[model samples]
Target: MASRLVAAAASSSSSSASPLARLISRRRLAGGADPHGPAKVNLWQDPMSPSKWKEEHFVLASLSMWGVVMYGGFKIFAGGKKENKNEAVPTQV
Candidate 1:
Protein backbone atom coordinates (compact mmCIF):
# COMPACT_ATOMS: atom_id res chain seq x y z
CA MET A 1 0.00 0.00 0.00
CA ALA A 2 2.77 2.44 0.88
CA SER A 3 4.71 1.33 -2.20
CA ARG A 4 1.71 2.07 -4.45
CA LEU A 5 1.43 5.61 -3.08
CA VAL A 6 5.14 6.20 -3.65
CA ALA A 7 4.89 4.80 -7.19
CA ALA A 8 1.92 7.07 -7.95
CA ALA A 9 3.82 10.14 -6.74
CA ALA A 10 6.86 9.15 -8.81
CA SER A 11 4.75 8.73 -11.95
CA SER A 12 3.11 12.12 -11.40
CA SER A 13 6.48 13.81 -10.95
CA SER A 14 7.74 12.25 -14.17
CA SER A 15 4.63 13.44 -16.02
CA SER A 16 5.20 17.04 -14.84
CA ALA A 17 8.18 17.23 -17.24
CA SER A 18 5.95 16.61 -20.28
CA PRO A 19 5.32 19.51 -22.73
CA LEU A 20 1.56 19.56 -22.02
CA ALA A 21 2.25 19.34 -18.30
CA ARG A 22 4.76 22.23 -18.51
CA LEU A 23 2.20 24.44 -20.29
CA ILE A 24 -0.35 23.74 -17.58
CA SER A 25 2.26 24.43 -14.88
CA ARG A 26 3.18 27.81 -16.42
CA ARG A 27 -0.46 28.84 -16.62
CA ARG A 28 -0.98 27.89 -12.95
CA LEU A 29 2.25 29.62 -11.90
CA ALA A 30 1.05 32.82 -13.66
CA GLY A 31 -2.21 32.66 -11.64
CA GLY A 32 -4.12 31.71 -14.83
CA ALA A 33 -7.11 33.90 -15.86
CA ASP A 34 -8.87 36.69 -13.95
CA PRO A 35 -11.29 34.80 -11.71
CA HIS A 36 -13.66 37.79 -11.32
CA GLY A 37 -13.86 38.70 -15.03
CA PRO A 38 -16.64 37.69 -17.43
CA ALA A 39 -15.88 34.46 -19.28
CA LYS A 40 -15.74 33.99 -23.05
CA VAL A 41 -17.59 30.68 -22.94
CA ASN A 42 -18.01 28.58 -26.07
CA LEU A 43 -21.35 28.77 -27.87
CA TRP A 44 -21.70 24.99 -28.07
CA GLN A 45 -21.30 24.69 -24.30
CA ASP A 46 -24.56 24.66 -22.32
CA PRO A 47 -24.98 28.27 -21.09
CA MET A 48 -27.51 27.23 -18.45
CA SER A 49 -25.23 24.61 -16.91
CA PRO A 50 -23.48 26.98 -14.46
CA SER A 51 -26.35 29.40 -13.90
CA LYS A 52 -30.12 28.96 -14.10
CA TRP A 53 -31.99 31.20 -16.57
CA LYS A 54 -34.64 33.34 -14.95
CA GLU A 55 -37.53 35.32 -16.51
CA GLU A 56 -35.06 38.15 -17.19
CA HIS A 57 -33.15 35.94 -19.61
CA PHE A 58 -36.16 35.22 -21.77
CA VAL A 59 -37.33 38.84 -21.61
CA LEU A 60 -33.95 40.20 -22.65
CA ALA A 61 -33.62 37.70 -25.51
CA SER A 62 -37.14 38.44 -26.71
CA LEU A 63 -36.52 42.18 -26.72
CA SER A 64 -33.20 41.85 -28.53
CA MET A 65 -34.59 39.50 -31.18
CA TRP A 66 -37.60 41.72 -31.66
CA GLY A 67 -35.31 44.71 -32.32
CA VAL A 68 -33.23 42.69 -34.78
CA VAL A 69 -36.28 41.63 -36.78
CA MET A 70 -37.64 45.16 -36.79
CA TYR A 71 -34.32 46.56 -38.07
CA GLY A 72 -34.13 43.86 -40.78
CA GLY A 73 -37.63 44.69 -42.02
CA PHE A 74 -36.84 48.42 -42.10
CA LYS A 75 -33.62 47.78 -44.02
CA ILE A 76 -35.46 45.63 -46.55
CA PHE A 77 -38.14 48.21 -47.34
CA ALA A 78 -36.09 51.39 -47.01
CA GLY A 79 -33.95 50.59 -50.13
CA GLY A 80 -31.07 52.07 -48.07
CA LYS A 81 -29.30 55.26 -49.17
CA LYS A 82 -25.90 53.71 -50.09
CA GLU A 83 -27.06 50.93 -52.44
CA ASN A 84 -26.87 52.93 -55.74
CA LYS A 85 -23.44 54.37 -54.85
CA ASN A 86 -22.01 50.93 -53.91
CA GLU A 87 -23.49 48.84 -56.74
CA ALA A 88 -20.65 48.00 -59.22
CA VAL A 89 -19.82 51.71 -59.53
CA PRO A 90 -18.90 52.19 -63.23
CA THR A 91 -15.30 53.20 -63.95
CA GLN A 92 -14.40 56.19 -66.19
CA VAL A 93 -15.68 56.13 -69.82
Candidate 2:
Protein backbone atom coordinates (compact mmCIF):
# COMPACT_ATOMS: atom_id res chain seq x y z
CA MET A 1 0.00 0.00 0.00
CA ALA A 2 2.81 2.46 0.92
CA SER A 3 4.68 1.67 -2.35
CA ARG A 4 1.54 2.34 -4.38
CA LEU A 5 0.91 5.65 -2.61
CA VAL A 6 4.51 6.78 -3.21
CA ALA A 7 4.30 5.96 -6.90
CA ALA A 8 0.99 7.75 -7.23
CA ALA A 9 2.36 10.88 -5.56
CA ALA A 10 5.41 10.87 -7.79
CA SER A 11 3.33 10.53 -10.94
CA SER A 12 0.93 13.30 -9.91
CA SER A 13 3.73 15.77 -9.18
CA SER A 14 5.57 14.92 -12.39
CA SER A 15 2.52 15.39 -14.63
CA SER A 16 0.41 17.89 -12.70
CA ALA A 17 2.56 21.01 -12.80
CA SER A 18 0.49 23.99 -14.03
CA PRO A 19 1.17 25.59 -17.38
CA LEU A 20 2.59 28.70 -15.75
CA ALA A 21 4.96 26.64 -13.66
CA ARG A 22 6.23 24.79 -16.72
CA LEU A 23 6.67 28.02 -18.63
CA ILE A 24 8.55 29.65 -15.78
CA SER A 25 10.83 26.63 -15.37
CA ARG A 26 11.55 26.47 -19.07
CA ARG A 27 12.26 30.22 -19.27
CA ARG A 28 14.62 30.04 -16.33
CA LEU A 29 16.55 27.17 -17.83
CA ALA A 30 16.88 28.85 -21.21
CA GLY A 31 17.42 32.47 -20.16
CA GLY A 32 19.68 31.87 -17.17
CA ALA A 33 22.42 30.24 -19.19
CA ASP A 34 24.96 32.76 -20.54
CA PRO A 35 26.39 30.58 -23.25
CA HIS A 36 27.27 33.41 -25.60
CA GLY A 37 30.40 34.53 -23.71
CA PRO A 38 32.34 34.34 -20.48
CA ALA A 39 30.89 35.86 -17.35
CA LYS A 40 32.19 39.25 -16.15
CA VAL A 41 33.66 40.13 -12.76
CA ASN A 42 33.84 43.19 -10.56
CA LEU A 43 36.40 45.90 -11.26
CA TRP A 44 38.28 45.42 -8.01
CA GLN A 45 38.21 41.64 -8.23
CA ASP A 46 40.17 41.66 -11.50
CA PRO A 47 41.66 45.08 -12.12
CA MET A 48 44.01 43.91 -14.85
CA SER A 49 41.28 42.68 -17.19
CA PRO A 50 38.99 45.49 -18.34
CA SER A 51 37.45 43.17 -20.91
CA LYS A 52 36.38 40.81 -18.16
CA TRP A 53 34.92 43.60 -16.05
CA LYS A 54 31.18 44.04 -16.04
CA GLU A 55 29.54 46.62 -18.29
CA GLU A 56 28.46 48.88 -15.46
CA HIS A 57 31.99 48.94 -14.05
CA PHE A 58 33.40 49.97 -17.39
CA VAL A 59 30.85 52.77 -17.67
CA LEU A 60 31.58 53.98 -14.16
CA ALA A 61 35.33 53.94 -14.75
CA SER A 62 34.97 55.84 -18.00
CA LEU A 63 32.73 58.46 -16.44
CA SER A 64 35.05 58.88 -13.51
CA MET A 65 38.04 59.33 -15.81
CA TRP A 66 36.22 61.98 -17.81
CA GLY A 67 35.13 63.76 -14.67
CA VAL A 68 38.72 63.90 -13.47
CA VAL A 69 39.93 65.19 -16.79
CA MET A 70 37.24 67.86 -16.93
CA TYR A 71 37.89 68.94 -13.38
CA GLY A 72 41.64 69.13 -13.99
CA GLY A 73 41.19 71.15 -17.14
CA PHE A 74 38.77 73.50 -15.41
CA LYS A 75 41.23 74.09 -12.60
CA ILE A 76 44.11 74.70 -14.99
CA PHE A 77 42.14 77.27 -17.01
CA ALA A 78 40.16 78.76 -14.11
CA GLY A 79 43.19 79.99 -12.18
CA GLY A 80 43.18 83.33 -14.04
CA LYS A 81 39.44 83.87 -13.61
CA LYS A 82 39.72 84.22 -9.84
CA GLU A 83 42.13 87.13 -10.13
CA ASN A 84 39.65 89.04 -12.30
CA LYS A 85 36.94 88.65 -9.68
CA ASN A 86 39.26 90.08 -7.03
CA GLU A 87 39.76 93.36 -8.97
CA ALA A 88 38.04 96.36 -7.44
CA VAL A 89 34.93 97.55 -9.35
CA PRO A 90 34.90 101.23 -10.33
CA THR A 91 33.15 103.37 -7.66
CA GLN A 92 29.54 104.24 -8.65
CA VAL A 93 29.92 107.87 -7.26
Candidate 3:
Protein backbone atom coordinates (compact mmCIF):
# COMPACT_ATOMS: atom_id res chain seq x y z
CA MET A 1 0.00 0.00 0.00
CA ALA A 2 2.82 2.37 0.92
CA SER A 3 4.72 1.50 -2.26
CA ARG A 4 1.62 2.06 -4.35
CA LEU A 5 0.99 5.42 -2.69
CA VAL A 6 4.62 6.42 -3.28
CA ALA A 7 4.39 5.31 -6.92
CA ALA A 8 1.22 7.28 -7.47
CA ALA A 9 2.65 10.41 -5.84
CA ALA A 10 5.88 10.09 -7.78
CA SER A 11 4.06 9.71 -11.08
CA SER A 12 1.90 12.75 -10.38
CA SER A 13 4.87 14.88 -9.33
CA SER A 14 7.15 13.96 -12.23
CA SER A 15 5.74 14.55 -15.67
CA SER A 16 7.03 13.56 -19.10
CA ALA A 17 9.28 16.28 -20.51
CA SER A 18 8.40 15.42 -24.10
CA PRO A 19 5.15 17.39 -24.15
CA LEU A 20 6.83 20.60 -22.99
CA ALA A 21 9.69 20.10 -25.41
CA ARG A 22 7.29 19.49 -28.28
CA LEU A 23 5.29 22.58 -27.41
CA ILE A 24 8.43 24.71 -27.39
CA SER A 25 9.56 23.18 -30.71
CA ARG A 26 6.16 23.81 -32.29
CA ARG A 27 6.15 27.41 -31.07
CA ARG A 28 9.62 27.91 -32.49
CA LEU A 29 8.54 26.47 -35.83
CA ALA A 30 5.41 28.60 -35.91
CA GLY A 31 7.51 31.70 -35.27
CA GLY A 32 9.42 30.76 -38.47
CA ALA A 33 12.75 31.49 -36.88
CA ASP A 34 15.74 29.47 -35.75
CA PRO A 35 16.36 29.49 -32.03
CA HIS A 36 20.06 30.12 -32.73
CA GLY A 37 19.51 32.67 -35.47
CA PRO A 38 21.26 36.02 -35.89
CA ALA A 39 20.72 39.05 -33.72
CA LYS A 40 17.54 41.07 -34.19
CA VAL A 41 17.03 44.74 -33.39
CA ASN A 42 17.95 45.64 -29.84
CA LEU A 43 15.17 47.29 -27.88
CA TRP A 44 17.69 49.94 -26.81
CA GLN A 45 18.74 50.78 -30.38
CA ASP A 46 16.63 52.39 -33.10
CA PRO A 47 15.97 55.59 -35.06
CA MET A 48 12.62 55.57 -33.23
CA SER A 49 14.74 55.55 -30.03
CA PRO A 50 14.20 53.12 -27.16
CA SER A 51 14.36 55.66 -24.33
CA LYS A 52 11.55 54.00 -22.37
CA TRP A 53 13.04 50.56 -23.11
CA LYS A 54 15.84 50.96 -20.58
CA GLU A 55 13.41 51.95 -17.86
CA GLU A 56 11.09 49.10 -18.78
CA HIS A 57 13.95 46.60 -18.67
CA PHE A 58 15.03 47.87 -15.26
CA VAL A 59 11.52 47.67 -13.85
CA LEU A 60 10.89 44.20 -15.26
CA ALA A 61 14.25 42.89 -14.01
CA SER A 62 13.60 44.22 -10.53
CA LEU A 63 10.14 42.73 -10.43
CA SER A 64 11.33 39.37 -11.72
CA MET A 65 14.11 39.25 -9.15
CA TRP A 66 11.70 40.12 -6.37
CA GLY A 67 9.26 37.48 -7.57
CA VAL A 68 11.93 34.78 -7.67
CA VAL A 69 13.17 35.68 -4.19
CA MET A 70 9.68 35.75 -2.73
CA TYR A 71 8.74 32.46 -4.38
CA GLY A 72 11.88 30.73 -3.11
CA GLY A 73 11.31 32.05 0.38
CA PHE A 74 7.67 30.98 0.35
CA LYS A 75 8.58 27.49 -0.88
CA ILE A 76 11.24 27.12 1.79
CA PHE A 77 8.72 28.03 4.50
CA ALA A 78 5.47 26.59 3.11
CA GLY A 79 6.94 23.40 1.62
CA GLY A 80 8.05 22.07 5.00
CA LYS A 81 4.55 22.43 6.46
CA LYS A 82 3.01 20.63 3.49
CA GLU A 83 5.72 17.99 3.55
CA ASN A 84 4.76 16.82 7.04
CA LYS A 85 1.14 16.44 6.09
CA ASN A 86 1.75 14.67 2.78
CA GLU A 87 4.41 12.21 3.93
CA ALA A 88 3.61 8.52 3.35
CA VAL A 89 2.80 6.67 6.52
CA PRO A 90 5.01 3.68 7.39
CA THR A 91 3.45 0.26 6.88
CA GLN A 92 3.64 -2.55 9.44
CA VAL A 93 6.09 -5.36 8.72
In terms of TM-score, the best-performing candidate is 2
RMSD of 2: 10.4
lDDT (Cα, tens digit) per residue for candidate 2, span 1-93: 565456455556676665455433223366666658988899999998999999999999999999999999989988745444577889998
Ranking by lDDT: 2, 1, 3
Q: What lDDT does the true structure give each of the candidates?
A: 0.59, 0.76, 0.58
The residue ranges of model 3 lying beyond 4 angstroms of the native Cα positions read: 1-53, 80-93
Question: For residues 27-83, what per-residue lDDT tens digits would candidate 3 score against the true structure?
Answer: 324655544544444454642543434556656656888999999999898865543
Q: Specify the highest-lDDT model's number.
A: 2
* TM-score for each of the candidates: 0.34, 0.51, 0.31
Candidate 2: list runs displaced more than 4 Å.
1-33, 80-93
C-alpha root-mean-square deviation, candidate 3: 29.0
Question: Which residue pairs collide in model 2, if any?
Answer: none
**Angstrom error at residue 7, model 3:** 85
lDDT of 1: 0.59
- The TM-score-based order of candidates, best leading, equals 2, 1, 3
Worst 10 residues of 3 by lDDT: 19-28
Instruction: lDDT winner between 1 and 2, please give it.
Output: 2
